[model samples]
Target: MTEREPDSPVAEPATALGRMTPVDLSHPLEPGMTVWPGHPRFEHELLQCYTRGDASRHHRIALGEHTGTHLDAPVRFVPGGADIARTPLRALTGRAAVLRGPAGDTEVTPAALAEFEAAYGPVRPGDFALVDCGWAGRWNTSASLEPWPYVSVELAAALLEREVRMFAVDTPSPDPSDSRACPVHRLLLGADALIGENFTHIDRLTG
Candidate 1:
């Protein structure tokens, strides 16, 4: 088990005059939810059910850490990096920018990221930079498992230059599926930056 710090207090989101517009960025996790190949699939079993004459209901759930909409900590790729328990919550909560890529591409390059900046200003420090590659539409299908959009090492370097709080993607892994060396994961997470993967509904945020 990893040694962890005490839980920190989390502040509630600010509502405008008690009204809040919430955007759900996560995919629902079910018994048959899609998972990365070679990873255990999500499973759920009922421990107690009202239909079975039980007064209350409960369930036993099992899933990998990377299942569904999830965040990856530095410990995922870097030695001696912060684990989920040690990662600060504030790093995952902040202003987020949705960067759209050109249609029909499997790789987001440094030049595309530069184009994004040219249009929406530089990705400011402390922002969550989400790359939208139109891949979320392929969620849960075999096609999603195919070579999906991923960030190039150069783009990873540029994102690191911006000191982003978190980097998010709509695919399973930001690095190539067959990569023996995951340089992007190491570069970002090793710097204590967070990573959100398998994100859905990112296209809804893109202009």
Candidate 2:
């Protein structure tokens, strides 16, 4: 994963509040939205609205496949995976616990997992895992998501064995840059664990 140009413009100026508002983590899927080498290009067009004799109304919009803050069902990656429409309501409902970890820490090891679990409480059979890697600050640019952070194979298996439902990270992607195959993805997503990356301002958990 390489850095792409800051092709999209975000909301004008950051909020003045000491508390930060959520800046959108999704890239604007216009003619831009840097994709993998073979992904389809984003499209757009202008469709005119009702026109009067002297003037005409204007409407601009575009259509896309899973555009912006999209949900990718397992079927997206796995063959004959579950479709978004087919997803059960129970699969979407759960209790979210907010946990805080060290700053700049990557690769949440098995030992670290135990430390967190012990501090917060026992790891239930269906708890969600959130790793605050402080990676959200870089979401406005591409460099942030390129080199990501995540759980190791051992920890991944531990989570799976423990029946963890999902895992999310404040970082961009989970897995080292050097590896061609995304093992973290294979280990977690393959097991049907939801992974939410590029999560921003997770420090609010202290609240």
Candidate 3:
């Protein structure tokens, strides 16, 4: 875990906020961070530095739109679909229902989701349905390679049926790494629902 900056202010714990402490689900952007193969690698170039006689320190960052933690707008796969700027903020933020997947690099199927709902409760409409498969733990490592866990197309349909505002996962993509057709992406984005990928620290939400 990354330590907080010494000068940064401390945030209140969950107990202080009625058991609702905000959890940061984003990964830190940096050079050489793990990204899908064939995608642009993250880069950071020092632009100005006070030690170099410049007024301030700054950097020039270069990365793909899908770098690190990111959201997929309808335009990503849908023709003439709404772009990120047009996507409503309400759709991305809401009461999230975190579904914890079983251990290993397996497909998240409808049966697994139904089992989760049976244990907890049905995923309500307009909720951000985050599926945590623990893949974020492999970030920046060789284990982040292809064949990572992914959501099945059937589960995508189930989420769409539930009318979830967003279907998010910790892996690089909702579809399998070797997928050519990207069935899950098409199924969700085609319906105007957002998909958030590469989210880290999703397990913290349960805590």
Predicted model with the maximum lDDT: 3
Candidate 1: list runs displaced more than 4 Å.
Answer: 1-20, 103-105
Tell me the RMSD of model 3 versus the true structure: 8.4
lDDT of each: 0.81, 0.60, 0.86
lDDT of 3 by residue, 55-124 (tens): 9999988899998899999899998998999986666667777787766768888876787788778888
Which has the higher lDDT value, candidate number 1 or candidate number 3?
3
lDDT of 2 by residue, 166-188 (tens): 66666645566566787877777
RMSD of each: 6.6, 12.6, 8.4
* Structure candidate 1, residue pairs in collision: none
Q: What is the Cα-based lDDT of residue 207 in candidate 2? A: 20
Q: Candidate 2 regions off by >4 Å?
A: 1-72, 98-105
Ordering by lDDT:
3, 1, 2
Could you tell me every candidate's TM-score relative to the true structure? 0.86, 0.64, 0.86
Pairs in clash, predicted candidate 2: none
Query: Which of candidates 1 and 2 reaches a greater lDDT?
Result: 1
Q: Using alpha carbons, what is the TM-score of model 3?
A: 0.86
